[model samples]
Target: MEAFFKALLGEKAFLLDNNSKMIAPTMEGKKLHNLERLLLHVHVIVEEAEGRYIMNQAMVHQLNVLRKEMYRGCFIVDNLKRQGTESNNYKGHDVSNSFILSKFNPVKRLFLSDVDIHRETDLQQVIDNLSNIMEDVNGIVVFLNNYPPLYRQPYSMHLFIEKCMFRCQMEMGRIMAFLMQKEDQGCVGVLPIVGPTFVGKSTLVANVCNDARVRNYFFQTILITAHDINSENISTLKDGAVILHQNNALDQNNERLLAIIELSGDIDVVAWNSLLSSSSYLGRVSKMIITSRSDKITKFGTTQALVLTFLPLEAYWYFFKISVFGSIDSNDHPELQSIAMEIARGLNGSFVGANVTFSFLKDNLVAQYWRRYLSSFREATQRNVSLFRESPYGLVCDCKPITQLIRGDDEFAVWGRYHACPVEENVPMITMKDVIFGRGNYEGEFDVLAWKSHIPPYNSYIVKCVIEKSK
Candidate 1:
């Protein structure tokens, strides 16, 4: 709970006003009370050990207790005890907020006066008592006990991840390669850069969008995430004046599609076809980018796709040096730099973790430090994964698979296993477990792994994520 709370406590509070002052206390106690109460009834004991560490007899037992008491967001069945609802979803507050309300209540209590408990935020009154309010609230901090999937970076983040790793997808790249070369800019629609989950489709397109030079060219760049490929709620994303052609889209209409394609006036051929079919009016204008973790919708014929590969060790060295220590010409740490680059090469295309490891190395580090990092990087991550996925410690539960796309057999084919590789500041030397961490749920499931690598059947575009799995 403390760990999650810390991860959430950012420099600026999202719930604040223009002056950037927090305005509410919204009691998470109610949510926590409900979960603990449920646990107690089920004979699941939560012993408060050292450092607020919770010790329960069995996780399975805790799961059972959760099953009975879990309200909206955790399970499909609505928890009757709290809000008298039939389905698992809570009636009002979004699941994410409910989670924040529950997990951070500990540190939140420290800033109780800042929280507007009764829906009314009287900032002026609290302002008058600022000294009094801050007296009891001497810096509330959350030590690292856990990390939410947010820290994993979105599966779509492969876009940036690819730039750092240099393992960019060519399906989107080829289209850009063509568009940049040709005289004609194609129609404006959601250019479906279809590929299996974790296959670099989203990452590739996102990188192009993220490029500081190209980001403003589009009216809006949105990545819609869904648990299932086909979801009706998907329409809500396009309600505003923005583009919404990614993620689940079979259910979307030509109208929503039109809203997006028209928003950007004109675009390239791939995007034009995706947002609006050649059949629609505005769809005729060109330029759009679409990347899907699943083939929820089907339109337009198949096109050739270029599979992305890992960055060369040489590229990793340049990125690491510039991103961390900011220069490759460091005369002070030539030996350390050499060892760091070697370790970075071993990381494949995982630039994030490589960066983290390198940052750790910038300190009083040498051969011993490098060796220790190599020995423990993998284990630390396995432990971290469990912490990342550790359900909202009751108070409510909602689960979404961490999206990962390993290029299966279908070249340019259509994707888990959560996670690609670790993103640390320094390139930690890792062993077998680190590889296992990257391989994730696919371990021992050879057929699934093989099927993931198979790319022949789709006859469609396949893209790979930033990190590469050796297997």
Candidate 2:
């Protein structure tokens, strides 16, 4: 907001007229001049607060008020300038014509006196009032700085009796390999974990970070939270701080560092650019683990990103059961176990959904209650899945099996060749739309030939082809 007001004032280049000035030079245009000076001070305060990452509500409120006032001041100044310009253009033309123009644009003449305080005494009074507000602002800044930092409550996953990280070993290994790769030395190796929210990108990263190989490999491991990435944040970063150009010999073992940058969907492009630019100054090897819902954003400067996959049926059941029963067998709670399995299947590979659902059932462990949950599970899951589908949270609720090319209503208009692999195959008879779109209601009872391919060179394109036997 402060930045906005500063830019506006800079662009307008407001000045005072000598003819409109007071009789004496000392008393001339004092109020408007003081307003300009006060606005600059307001900009500086806001900028400083932002630089220091001050998020106090009181500070924000004060700054917002100042910004709005400055905005109004700028608007008034701008309107006056425009009116002056129009007045000059009509010079020697006609006084009646100018009056007509002012009538047409009533804003030019209307309420001018409301904010017009250019007199020496009036300006001095306003400036004194504004200057007093500056003392309040300074006090707010000091109060905010003295306030204690608030730490986020730790997630329940760490406290869970049984961590449900089943079937993620392969994913952990894949990401671990990327981090420990011998290639891409001297440059920061970026490994982006792109998935939907609550799909366990952070969990996967956490598991991999704790891996024996990864632990030994990186000398310094820093975790950056979801803060706006700017030059100041990067320069003042304490954890995972990479000492680049200068001798990074802090200890005898001068090993490279790894910085894990975790953020939700809202990405600041300018701040990220600044952070990346600062990395060039570092001398030693470094790696960045970036997590984002947008695959395009995460994989911006990387060869490939690890897209997280949900667990298979058996794996999901095991994961969910542990969260609910804590190493107890399904046979022990046979009455609710069947319904629990059904619930797990309906979860559609969402670890978040599974955890939340099972957590609900954990305390209310009754067959009748479980049955009631099972009955409405599909509808509830459907709504949840649909909501996530519209936004790129992660993969869909259910995996589109790799066996067949699922088509939608408007898919195929003509005979086209799709490379599932290098092999050529014929897909005939059915309209592409029917095959793709018609699969919505049809549950998979049997396997069909399906091929998944990534386009070469950049490997950015995903092509899936499903061939069903012609009836």
lDDT of each: 0.32, 0.49
Residue 334, model 2, lDDT? 49
lDDT of 1 by residue, 90-176 (tens): 224232333224535432232122222421232222222332322322222222132122234333222233233232322334544
TM-score of every model? Answer: 0.33, 0.41
The lDDT of model 1 is 0.32
In model 1, how large is the Cα lDDT of residue 32?
A: 31
Q: Which regions of candidate 1 are displaced past 4 Å?
A: 1-203, 210-217, 226-237, 240-285, 292-303, 321-325, 328-334, 363-368, 377-471
The numbered model that scores best in lDDT is 2
Per-residue error (Å), model 1, residue 132: 74
lDDT of 2 by residue, 149-174 (tens): 32244323223324324444446656
- Write down the RMSD of candidate 2 (Cα, Å): 26.7
**Model 1: worst 10 consecutive residues (lDDT sum):** 390-399
